[model samples]
Target: MSRHALGPEIHAQGTRFHVHSPDADRLWLCLFDAEDRETRLPMARDGKHAWSLDVPGAGEGTRYGIRVDGAYDPGAGLWFDPDKLLLDPYAAAIDRAFVYDPALAAPRGEGADTAPLMPKGVVTAPLPPVAAAPPLFRPGGLIYEVQVRGFTMLHPDIPETQRGTIAALGHPAVIDHLRRLHVSAVELMPVNAWIDERHLGPLGLRNAWGYNPVGWFALDPRLAPGGMAELRGAVAALHEAGIGVILDMVYNHDGESDAWGPTLSLRGLDARSYFRHEPDGRLINDMGTGNSIDCNHPLTQRLILDSLRHFVSAAGVDGFRFDLAPALGRLPTGFDPEAPLLQAMRADPLLSDRILIAEPWDIGPGGYQLGRFDEGWLEWNDRYRDDLRRFWRGDRCTLGSLATRLAGSSDIFGEGSRTRTVNFLAAHDGFTLADVTAYAHRHNEANGEQNRDGHGENFSWNNGVEGASANPAIQAARRRDIKALLGTLFCSRGTIMLTAGDEFGRSQQGNNNAYAQDNAIGWVDWTGRDREMEAYAFALAALRASQPDLQDVGWLTPGDVEWLDEQGQPLTVAQWEDPDRRCLAMRFRRSGLAIFVNGDDRPRSFGGVSVPARTVLPIPADQATA
Candidate 1:
């Protein structure tokens, strides 16, 4: 049995509340009535640094919070104020919306009572029956990374009331798109209860991406008005359609920002125990999100593990893509693959067989831990993403690098067990596929950061023009590059992830970091979508599914795959390093693929050569031919 089943547990008689606060001298359970009046009950401390209380009338749907009384010193990392109501760390449902107010964080002892404005944790009943489905996504499966809110925000098929909600993902039109693309998993972005960043509120913006998580167990009411049942139904629908759901999780950090940030949840309950801090009490900002969670702490580890179990057992999610996962494996000594949390997850019964992926790096020391996780864990291969982009952009000495990535990136993931690379060209973090070919530079002025928010160098080529161009020649060239990039991605060994709108040539106008722009800039415009480009994507998916070599789950043995130059001969070291070579061919079993990228402004071609029957389609082939 898990040690930390801390939350509001309902029974036939009443409900019992369990909370962890080792540093608190006294704890009180605050219950809110329908008219907003508060009733306080003293809680008893248990032997294992926990507080417990039982109320006879408190059953399901009771709104409550906790207030711990202890030292209110920030330098020593003891922040306990009874004035500011604290949310349960394991809250399954939040009754109201969370609005960031600076006054809620006023230096511990100086802040006014914030219970009137604070949201309370609701005692939720057990969720609906979670279908016992086997894991649908695997090592070589294709994952479609999408945001529940932004994915169908502007879709014409979704009803206005259901648009931008988790229920919208189950609409027939959305499922049809996934089926067409042969997507095995839908990696839904953060749906956890989160708050808009404090800075964003001042800047007249909001956190469009739910990376700033607040409550670990509850679903954001804004995204899931119907609560866990709504999300479970959506997951059931996707499961019925043979698609798995991989949630993008943010346990690395919380919505609580810096020392001056809001005292919403963890910071108010037990800041010293919940968050990592320096000796003098300053936060460890490894996540680049103001504060890094104390992932290695015993209590924190149990909280995270329990949350994983709750999602899998109650909501029926297939897997999780951990954002900033390096923080989870980091300890005071350094990053250890054998970290307790990592080892526990690997050994756990509920999570052992599920898909676990890592965006395997943070902004801390030794943070660039790409391919450093355990064998069972898959990592987002940024090396594969960058090298593929640079090769198609005609960068010098890229043929050898491209070949390495095409063959499951043995350089990064190592040899035999390296086939778990999550290969991708574009993700939610950077520019879209169409924007990569249409704009060479990032245009993020819309983010109110003076066009300085996103990555400086995109490894992109604009086909001679900087932005959108009217010339037919440039458009044709850009479209050809798009096809070439998609060809390499599908043909690569290992798992492949496609961003939501990239299949049909969606553009962000060059706003790579549209994490703040929730309006037209971030939403996927289904109206007037590029049907031709979409068809091409469908064809590539079909081809990948049909080809066994492309979906190979192990490192290719010596004779399994061969790389060739444009002349249909084995690639020489000299030719591989040649800057002038922009064309390469790959042969696997009976099927062969040839990619010709004209990154240069003028036309370029290679001598005609005959290949095997399972041949490469013409660049930008007709949908019928495809």
Candidate 2:
């Protein structure tokens, strides 16, 4: 059987189910009816390490699962138990979403049949493929990172029935917001089928972010009740609005976490073949998840490629943002830039032109592979996030660093002709722009870990009082700091990213790691938004979009850009080395656009431009090129 053909294939005659299990002693295909009655049939060995069975008259709408029988040897990495019904890795749809249950994790024969506790794969007929088109997005464009459910859940304009679903993204209000921000694309966080971590249940929390996935092709029913059709419609609407869609995919690990997790999928099918393990049989924790996918394995590669193609052809997404992307290139020797999987993706005709972005790091050895991916890829630049935050927070010795980031980080990207940096002030995992200026430390006591679950050093500071201060003076200072940060981000080179709700002063109450707070803490509060800040962000975006010089991804050269001091002359060596200095002007000689920055507490004038304290001033368009 073909590698990509491991899933069920339907024809007029019947449906043929194919499963790859090289080590199973036996295998069976279990079919169920509307009443939840099951009929099990033995599968005949098809090839060297696979099984197959043909059921006549069975076609779309069939609910089924696979049962693998093998010696339960944990030390040898063989975990097969027929009692645990497993989901097909290629399942496009499941009857229901997965929920945590202790019975699902019981050892072989120790627990009752798990079929009652697992979701059954539903057979689906393929939808008409979306007509391919060139992606509307490109390097140097703005990407809006969106948490589908969190972003739409509490949106007042969206009807309550459709509020939290993928369909709600197509609502007029949502599109209007993206348009105002001049977003080139919306990066939807993981919408694939996933199970919450076992620990979250006891704490009365659930995973709001869909990072822990089980089936690659299965769209989480909670997010899209209408299945792939819902995603297709949303993508079509976004495309109509001239905005592309980018799905964030997690291929590093499955929800079958650690040794104590459930066996809902790959682990029950073929553990050794599906996961990376040591010679002694322990699973590798490269992704910080219980186990990492064996990307080097051909079977794993086939599933990943098929999943990507499915979204592109079936749902019309422009591209994908890989979570913990180093896992895609990890091999037995180490992380190789030319790893087979990465090479295959670039070489594949279906995905070659689609935008490929890498998170660029994981918890594994040599995992921080910044600027290591090939020229076809763009990477998330955390260095840009930190150094800029420090500079705007009045840190010493940040003037030079600020210049470097604004010039697209020549030190990191090697001063290339074009940069692959995705600049940002804050992301989904950290403090919001408002929180960054209002909290010196994290307030994650609500996570039930006593504030130990989030980052200890966030490079943050409270303007005067930490979190929710009613002092009018303090509020004014916080607003100034946020505007300064936004100015720095919009003025920076290369592709930029802004997390959802950061523009309108959304806050997680200093909960940097609110992955489990699926409630108001994680949702974007549309009602409490600041109109002034929102308008400021929109104006910044308009300015950035209108300025051709700012959109260029290439490194700014001495002939194209000039750095000036308060005297309106080129910055002297001493001034460049002055750690206390916080005022300078970056003049784009080509377009004569000058961005004057004042990082000090006192207002200052640069070359006769009176810039307020902690503000970035862009010379008016009328006199910019004069």
Candidate 3:
């Protein structure tokens, strides 16, 4: 009903297609037949930068695109040409298996017809009406992050036909695993159709992580082989099992790279308004990807909001985790907590209460907005991740930092009465929990970056061995550290997220940045999983659900949680800052839960004052309790 609804509106008799090209002099609505012949139909502009047309004969399954004639210039960032067939920025369905050709990146003056290589937009059939449901997962719930393709690719119980597809997520084996872990929600990585980076094609590597999104509306065929219906069905199945589905959305940037990249959807249609460019016309590289999207633009903001509504209203996604969220909140002046886009999302009737999480940083100027988001929005606490890793890895002078993190990052999140922290020790971009203790440094040579692609400082210890070792002592120590890390996450006072295979101790051979490793290196090895670690994780999840103090809605104070020394006494300021002390104990005042962590090599004595009684509990270095 609103003018901002700029996509194809499917009806029984015909389809009304709408697009926005502010600078276009002329626009043609082109429809392709089964034989690939194009029917050129002129479109009318509303004189306000909006173009629309209704085709009575063009109903569902109609493949159409737009051809615009306008000023074409690269330096000034006004790249528009009628010759190249441009996709609908709001296309709901695209042809499967989109193939990228280098010719598409060339200037329109090159006279290269990319229509043959371009994927067409299909007019989708009207979806059956369904009632909207309330959100399932809430604050302080366990979120299991998973990549659709890599998660079930090697699953033994899933059928070969369904393996590596969205349908596989609802499989009995997969659902059973989540149920066993007591997972409240599954945060799926990007499902949007994406193009591999231009450089990866030449190097024989593929984009395993779907971070490089090209089509914001259409699902990636490789991940969602059966399209939107399959994704909806999977969400329904997960909901039936009492698990919510949260999608990781990327609106900060697209698959379209810098000046040398392809003229795909927005770049080919209207580059000036779609992307941010400097005074000299050089594109802004805020996302560290080629061109940063100008999200503040009215049309760009409309597209993003419409896409979010579509996912929730049509695809049934329960929530969204915005990747590189600061880019979306940035304005001409600076990042605003009350940015138009963020405000629109929170005020929208369809999305207000849905779970919204932010990976609150970008590579742009002043982009690290760790805990500065609006009160209701939860953030990925990278500080919590680093502090937990450093403390559990035997780094010294970390007790003070670890104490803050264990109390829901009160120093960063401000001890507010809001659910703000999504604590995680490791995520998709870095080494696995197993690799954290089995490899000291990253080994990302497979990414074709000469071993310089991933994080240089991982704070990982190899347990005295560089790689895999047959020494049982080293292996046992690694397992102990893994347990300690998992326990720390569960006992912390906030929501927790665990990467897919981390529960079973799956490793990437120390490849921290495996975004380009599409083969076995990225897939989860289910057969060789560590069953003991899996059981331990399951136990921790059970403990978290059963205990109330671990899921505190607000930040914990000294009155709520007390830090203690090995002798069951309140830790002194000097002892808290001791560089050599690696063992600590935490006792929750109300819950009386005692967590003793010994990061040292040998056994250590731990004491805690629980229930008005000072009790000293001797905890073996191997016994890291949750």
Tens digits of per-residue lDDT, candidate 2, 456-505, equal 88889998798999899999999999999999999988899999999989
Checking candidate 3 for backbone clashes, the offending pairs are none
lDDT, each prediction: 0.83, 0.90, 0.84
Q: Higher-lDDT candidate among 1 and 2?
A: 2
Off by more than 4 A, model 3: 1-4, 415-419, 607-626
Residue-by-residue lDDT tens digits, candidate 1, 113-162: 88977889999998754656668887797999998898899999999999
- CA lDDT of 54 in candidate 1? 82
Q: Which stretches of candidate 2 lie over 4 Å from their true place?
A: 1-4, 415-419, 624-626
2 or 3: which has the higher lDDT?
2
| C-alpha TM-scores of all predictions | 0.94, 0.98, 0.95
Which 10 successive residues of model 1 have the least lDDT summed? 617-626
- Candidate 2: give the clashing pairs: 258-290
Model 1 spans > 4 angstroms off: 1-4, 128-131, 416-419, 590-626
